[model samples]
Target: MRFDPQPASYRPDPAILPLAPWLGDPVEAATFPRHDLRFRNDRWARAVGLAELSDAAWVDHFGRFAPLSDNLPQPLALRYHGHQFRVYNPEIGDGRGFLFAQLRDGDDRLLDLGTKGSGRTPWSRTADGRLTLKGAVREILATEMLEALGVYTSKTFSVVETGEELVRGDEPSPTRSAVMTRLSHGHIRIGTFQRLLVLEERDHTQRLVDYCLEHFPGPTPPEDAPDRDNPAVRLLHQVVERLADLAASWMVAGFVHGVLNTDNMNISGESFDYGPWRFLPKWEPGFTAAYFDQQGLYAFARQPEAVQWNLGQLAIALRPLCDAKPLVAALDRFGPLYTAALAKRWCWRLGVAPRGEDADARLVSACERAMREDGSQPDAFFHRHRGGRNANDELAEALQGYAAVEDEAEYWSDDRPETMVIEEVERIWAAIDRHDDWTALTGKIAAIRRMGAAHGEPPVPVGHIRRDRT
Candidate 1:
């Protein structure tokens, strides 16, 4: 493939370095035993102007952790504290991953190339910094499927098998090892701001807020918002808006993120760090993704509450910079925003034109009732009743006057829609682990993309730069 020579292509912009010692620490990549390039996202590569690299070059950068030209001279392990399971922990940070590179995408949106299993940093504590090959494979599947399902998520840009045997309590011991790279909108988390708050670094917190507002532009705060022009208030407003929609998107896609901690919650509102995530088999409210989540803290139906709570933590973090009243007001907007977003996204998945919020809400409720009563999986339910074609009494009434978005895509004619439940994921991984086959993974990706095409363009994420929604 020919590399695009446009200036926007390969534009390395390491914007985080200026935040220096206070933000993170410079670190070295681990010396791996071998480098085997496994998965390369050529589609996103072309979008970011890295499509021209050969397999060897790809491994050199992602596996060996070589610095991208014009990017950071070395990897920087970010520092942030988060509330893990409602308990505040100041010890956690980027123990396993670091920001490898930063650049703009084709749309001029800033993106970060961050690594998982690259190496240990100052935050390594008592854990190995390497990722299991199975973990890498799971992330690839999670990102691909979530993207197709219209969830704003980090893209698994590249995966390289680092020849190493690692032991873990959760998986089989001495399993295969690999390093995966995530291409995301930004790596700034609510915990990033929380770190500053803990240190009593008011100026640094304000600077970080300014950086986020400038880099990830969002809609201006409402005219009635207290301190609407204040950087801290504006940033809070933006994050609240994006995350409300994010929660709704996940709900519509039948996804349970499993963890919604402050550090895991990206400031840009894109979902990342897919650990123990799952899609619903049917409409089960208490379904949890992580096996250890015994309390069902981040269950399927409770995701929106988890997100709203995280946003509240962010507001707490920002109190040092702005008045608490304005931040509280911004946080209060989450409910309305989430309600509207759920209606819109739910309608999108059903392939019906959305009416006003009240009508759309009724349609969503009816569909959920039908699925729960019929014991139908979400993937099957949506596909079987697209445009209200096969709806029952309640759902049919709710779908009245809602014209279907015109599309002749063959995926719409399929007997069943593609799903990424645990069984299918394990089966795909079994093929890769036993026979060293990648066809199953590749084929599933292709099918998922076709499904996304039939759904058309996803709604533009809030706070993202305006562009063609179609």
Candidate 2:
């Protein structure tokens, strides 16, 4: 648990592009000699076998910003552009970040590892490449927590604080600097593909489609493989599926991304960039954490819709690659996929069988009504510690009561918790008393409570929860 402060060798990969004429001079830095960061705790990192990368010799061989000489990633800097919130921004891509090149672990799968705020690049338009320490810290926290919660996300490899200085409007005085690196499947974004397509460069678009299909591989199910010469149709379907699944995950977790801009949407569909994200303390469809989301474009409950909108942009970007019919078909799957995903996740959260065909639609609509009148707080919540009752039964009853109470009261607000809140939860479950199967459901519920009450030592990973069915 102690901080290891001994001096250590440091280095960066020298095989990198020099600063463009417009960019500022590069100031060199290194990861603190000791793997002093919390997430990279010498122990946990070792458990993950990342400790091998922590070795100083390996650092020289692998890290671009590691202390010592200049050993860096194989290929660096991906060139691309994006539309920021629907506005064209011709200049974008790793302005303060660089892909140090992909690295293979024991599995032989190459992981695209990269550093953020590692000094400036040609794209460093009007900004410093130095990242504020706090920004890096927040990113680490977000990644670790998300992974533990069962969401696929980028993982923080390391963060080395540059004891020196930089100024930023968002933080306190001259901010401390740090370089944060993330392990991702790849950095290709919807914007990366869209940028060239916007330039009307068909040849480049074709190449981009090939690259994405080979790497990101969107949703082309086996039977509907795209025409080989026609990679666009393939790429279109792939992205649509990934995007739908990603939206569903966000919905299940009650997360508001705050920004659903195309530039932030990755082709691989993994959620990246945690800026301005907030998890709902309790479910409320209307709540948004991103301060700039004035229009609620990326509201808590509208995430699926927001992602679909971003996918529509991708649809435009890839339009050159596919026929109109297939493109239409790919886009059409978004709604159903998102709905199905939501139900699957909701069912898991409640520990019950998925519902009747109309159940999901009705629940969502009911929540909409309750959100308006009952102060959008969730009628029921997920218990991470399992062994509780069947979630569906408990929640359905609670919601039924809550809605009845709201209707009887004849007035409501989505932002407030009223006298009816607790009453309704209790009122709704009374029906469980009549069911012959209630005993079994109640046993599961009681089991969940028993699990919750046991020593509150942190849970083992959900993957460890029970691979075998109960």
Candidate 3:
């Protein structure tokens, strides 16, 4: 238990987001590398007691002056427009990104952690708001691999490479600038309800829709939401039921943020930005993660319709603050709340038990007849059907002339270790799969130091990811 980056007291939410006079000031544009940190994993190993803090004291107390917590939300560098693939940029807001503050954690909640390439600013248009230690090691390996595939994402904390350098004529040599820190819950976008439904600004868009239904509408508040239901069209069916359970937890953990826009939706419907993100390691619902999306428009099966077209740009940014038959009933709550939160997050990542009617129309006709003919790689069809693995001759040569696994020839199955483990999840997935089989990659760091001598856990690497706190 050796880490703590000194935090008994460290305030910053000092506020200042009112920049929209056509946004111009924010341009310091670079800083990071008071010493670089390239440690790579164990999800920022913030080991036990958050290991005595340094890695440059987790960048000056978690997120260097995180834009000095912009005095708690009144900070407004906001104003936006999007439709990247459908066309219609009309310029955007938080361009190279910025909104570096808004605290309240030790459980009381209110997060927002921001800071992507802490450089340029005034909505960085001519480029270089700097961020590229290969995009901060691909957003610290895409937010700790989507927080170990559990999802509700956005939480890197600090990555800071920027030993300083930049050229990006689109990567490879001549690129280095970096800075990161995520944690989020409300960077408030969907284009801040599409810039208050395109400037009709009804009382500052109903005071930002009553500051997002007095802090996220969940454990109460939806008693059939306002008028036949219009608490801003049932908070857009509760942010499309948390962005269709965050695009069915990024289609059961193959993620691909690639840029969903409506200023990268968040107010709690997590999975913020990891730029051209990726992780399908084989899957391919036209898998994308931006390389200029070549018209796939944020693919991986068009990420729940690019998050229901950024929740129809937050029902056209909460349609001038509501009323036109509850703004088309809050844009019909993004297709049955993103198809029943992507069929209960794909029946809890393929353990598959949920099926209230045609078993979700036979798993969306076995995922659109295997993503429309011969579709077999989505991680080798879920590591051979849900990670059990056997490979049936590499799934009959990667679904050769597909009969779509010949109508699942009596549900061709396997990876069903009853849905991704539980009872001590195979003693931590057989110790990270025997530390990924054989040569004992430090045998689960010597069986967590002989189970940290009866569950105390402090053997240190900063007491290992506290393996989910014991």
Candidate 4:
């Protein structure tokens, strides 16, 4: 690993440390028994200029937790408080993971290198701070599929299998262990602000607002915003727009995040921390991803509601820095914004140019009704009707005058669309577990990317400013 030549062209930026000590606690990484490289995301690695790192160097920094130059000197377990399943938990923070490093991509956008299953932190409570190999594999699959479906999500950068047998109640006994690194736009969550509010750190909260505004630049505040120029109000409005789009994307993609806690809601609006997530196998509104979510708080159809509730929590957290009226006004935009996003995304998925709002919504309703009547999965339904083909009755009438986005694509001719349902995920995991084979997993990722390419570019998310340097 030649550090002088900088083969990776790394641009390390310790962007989070300025809010540190109070923001998080420096912690040591756990000593793993082995550092066997299992997975490497060369695509994203190259995007961030880390593709040149030797496998040994990759393991040294990510698996062994060596600090990158000009990055964080040590892993910092970020402090946060979140409402877990609607119950406030002040003891929670970075239990099994920490922000490892921050850097810039080719576009000069700040990116975070965060870890999962790295080690125990102050927030570990009584649970072991380790991730099962199965868990890591699932996250890789989740991020890849979600990204392909155009959700702003984290990238699973690396997965190093540690030779440690772990016991997990959720899975089989003596499961394999591994540490996974995620590449994301930012690590600041709504819960980050919640922690500051609980501690009455108004000044620090204001600073955080400013930092987010500068780092994750978004659209200007609404003209009717009570305090259009106020940083706090602007941040709230931006978050509302992003999360609304996020919720719509998930709904249209037929994906369930499973966990929609306040901590899981990132300020930058990128989705991360995939635990027990699932893509819809059928158009079941009550379909759930996590077995523990028996109450269906974050169910398939309830995700939008859950997101709105979480945004309300963020508004409460920001109350110390801004007037409640402005925050409430920002929050009220969610319903209309989400409806528009749903229509836009629904049309995009169907590979047709969107019609007027009413027509698009009618088309979406007809499509959903058709799915329910036929009991078809989203993958089958979307593929069967791409470019407005194979439609009749309400769907056909609603799709009138909608032009196809493209004349033809090779993927459209395929017999079946790629899907990431639980059965397929388990099949890939089973190959790795029983036969130590990775071909199935890699093949699925490739196919997912191809499907995404066939769909063409997704709708640009609202409130996200393009920051790439030309």
Candidate 5:
């Protein structure tokens, strides 16, 4: 689709005041010889009031080095330390990218415009902070697929091809280069809080907590909640709940994040920093996405544990401001929360209204057993058996009391499910690499959207059976 050349309708509204005091060292974006704007998300742009920008203006704001009006005058490379694969690294931060700007979305939620492969910062330890065009494409695919599957993830706002040849050991040497931006709810990570603890900045930690509570507030705590008045404890509970839902969402979608480091865990519970991510071809607990994850530390099954561990680190960072008992209690709720979330999401993916807690649990177990016995891919399995219609005897029996929530659609008539396997992704990239062909990529995105629409929104778990239950 072509971008509209009209003047932008919406004015810029910056809301990053809470982070002003703690802003890190400012940095400049790299001056690329080429600024080829390849992709622009018009849907998201409209939501943010930037849909009407002319092509040149779009490139100027996203591609060129020009800063957004009323936004940050200069990019701020945030400071934070994280545990990479279980090892604490104090020398970590936004080495290549920085927080470019913050704006309110249609929902009035604060959204951050963060860059990847922009340029080097003080944290760029001996490495060039460049993002390959292939990496940017992969990120776009990852975020799009995850969003269609109902996962809370960042939107790949724009990808501009930078005129530079980058040599990397991963893919072909001297690969094409690009810079991308992500629109996320917030970038305040678990490691962000950890940095305050590392610096012994108790006052700063309190300020950060208040900022999050005000800007990135989560569900309100129960009336009987312990230390509910304390922003630290409240943030902890909210984060735990969000992370638990995230873990369950991944499981239902058959996605492996590959990297579950503290820095990658956003306070808003949205998934970002897509690297070495994968959609499982089948139900395998020990499946690992990244080649470097030989030990499967963040394996498919271990993701929950990994995220919980990261939460523990966040709790540790908040220890100075809140009691330990309340934090531990919050952490302990992960399992139950994950279990409940999985059941609800599973029912949604299957196009079935949840029967009840116990019945839905039994249905989930039955579905898993069927998939394992049949050796079917999760995507295909879910697509074929939506509403528990085309299931085997066991799954059929388990889903007997539940009814389908979605009506028949064109996507349901397709011979195969739309999947983002490695092979398919490579093929799409090959078309782009050999010849600047975006047809395949665009087509795949359309198919994925169709599937998402066919599945419809998740049904609320009502104990009473629907009259339409077949």
Candidate 6:
């Protein structure tokens, strides 16, 4: 599909006010002559007021890596530290990518245009900073599927295939190269806070808290709470709630993020930076996505624990600004909050109206038991029984009190539900590799969207409701 930018509703607002203190030195993007724009997310473009740029302009900005006129004059390679597999890695940062620009969405919320496979930077660390086209394709698939499943995620805004052959240890040698951009709420991460703490920059830590509170405020803290007015405590509470909901969403969608490292965890609670992600074929907690994860530290069932541990690191980072006890209090809420979010998400995915906390919990348990017993594909299982249909004796008992919220769609009438299993993904990629056929990928995306529409929107995170109690 080709697009020409018309009179764009484009509104550029470089609102990363904290960039001055948080960003590292500017870097130049590698200029590739072939700016073959492969993908443009028009849905998100319209939402961001950028639905109208000419094709040439789009390529110039996203493909050729030209600086946006009113956006950041130069790409800022953001500096931060993160723990890789529970090991502290102070050397970690934006090695291959940088923040391209920032703008406000139609909702006036700040959004970031961050790059992947753009070029090398100081953090590149002796490695060429180019992304294989297959890697970019995988990210597109990951983000698209996650969004369809109602996970708050980054949107792959643009992808341009650069004419270069990259050799990689994984995948075939001399794979094609590409540059892509992801539009996300904010790039601030749990690791971002860790960097501040490591530098002994208590004041910067407080500034970062203020930045998050102002830009990405969550439900207000309880009015009677000791740290209700404390921005640090409030931010911690908000991160916990968002991350918990994120973890639950992944579980309900049967997604394994593969990497739950601190650097990959966005503070805005949006999931991005997809790598080695997978959707489970059956209900198995020990399923690991990455080949390198021999220890299964980030297995499907352990995702909640991994995320909570990351939250703990974030809490520890907040110690410079607030009493550790208040942060602990906020951290303590993660377990119950995650449980509530999981139940709500599970009900939504199953197309059932939540009867109540206890009943919903029972329904989730019953669904799990049914899936395990039948050894069913997660997506198919949810698609088949959506709205409480085709339930066996066990599931019927738990589903008795609840009602299905969605009507059956035509897609469900098919013999099998559309799924993104590993083999199917490889089949799609093989077509691209051999014949440059994008039909399968595009068709699969459309099917996934239909499945999402069949289920309706997911329920809002339970922790989002504010309990003021003044």
Which numbered prediction scores highest in lDDT against the true structure?
A: 4
How far is 110's C-alpha from truth in model 1 (Å)? 1.3
TM-score of each: 0.97, 0.69, 0.32, 0.97, 0.94, 0.95
Supply the global lDDT for candidate 1.
0.88
lDDT accuracy of residue 408 in candidate 4: 62
What local distance difference test score does each model get? 0.88, 0.54, 0.52, 0.88, 0.83, 0.83
Model 6, 316-433: lDDT tens per residue? 9999888888889888989998999999999888877778789888888988998898899999998889788988798998888687674757866878887778888899889988
Model 1 C-alpha lDDT per residue in residues 250-272, reported as the tens digit of each score: 99999998988899999988899
Candidate 2 C-alpha lDDT tens digits along 1-470:
11211222222223223321111223343333332232343322332244656445444423345432233323355566676666778777767777764433332233456678776776778987767666665675555444433355677766655554778775566856666777666677777777767678777777666655654533344476435245776676667777776687677656667888888887777788777776665657788878777888788878887788778777788777676666666778888767776665554433334454477556545434543554433323343212223324433443442211011111111232221122332232333323312343234333322332221222121221111111
TM-score of 5: 0.94
The sequence of per-residue lDDT tens digits that candidate 5 reaches over residues 1-470 is: 11221233354555665565574778899888899998898867776677888889988888875888787888888889899999999899999888888876545566788999999999999989999999999999998888778787888999999989999987898889999988887788999999989899999999888888878766666577787778898888888888888888899989999999999999888889998999898898899999999899999989999999999999999999988988888888888888888999998888888778899899989988887888889999988887677876888889887988756677777888889888999999999999989999888877776766666554322221111111
Clash numbers, per candidate: 0, 27, 30, 0, 0, 2
- Best-first order by lDDT: 4, 1, 6, 5, 2, 3
Q: At residue 50, what lDDT does model 2 achieve?
A: 49
In model 1, the number of clashes is 0
- Candidate 3 lDDT over 1-470, as tens digits, reads 21222232333332224323332234343545554554322332332123345566556533344334234332234456666666656567665556555554333344555667676655668976767655664565555445544566666666655577678776565745667656566666666655555556566666665566655545322455545444566566566666766776677666677777666677557776766666654446786867787877778878887787777766766666456665555556667655665665554444344545445545644644553455454434543454222334433343233222111211234332111111322353343333433223234333323322221211111111112222
Estimate the lDDT of model 4. 0.88
Evaluate residue 220 in candidate 1 and report its C-alpha lDDT on the 0 to 100 scale: 94
- Least accurate 10 contiguous residues by lDDT in model 6: 461-470
Pick the winner on lDDT between candidates 2 and 6: 6
Sequence-dependent TM-score of model 3: 0.32
| Deviation of model 5 at 163, angstroms | 1.6
Better of 1 and 3 by TM-score: 1
Q: Write the per-residue lDDT of candidate 4 for residues 115-184, one digit (tens) a residue.
A: 9999899999997899999999999999888777777788899999999999988889898999999998
Kindly provide the TM-score of model 1 when superposed on the true structure, using C-alpha atoms.
0.97
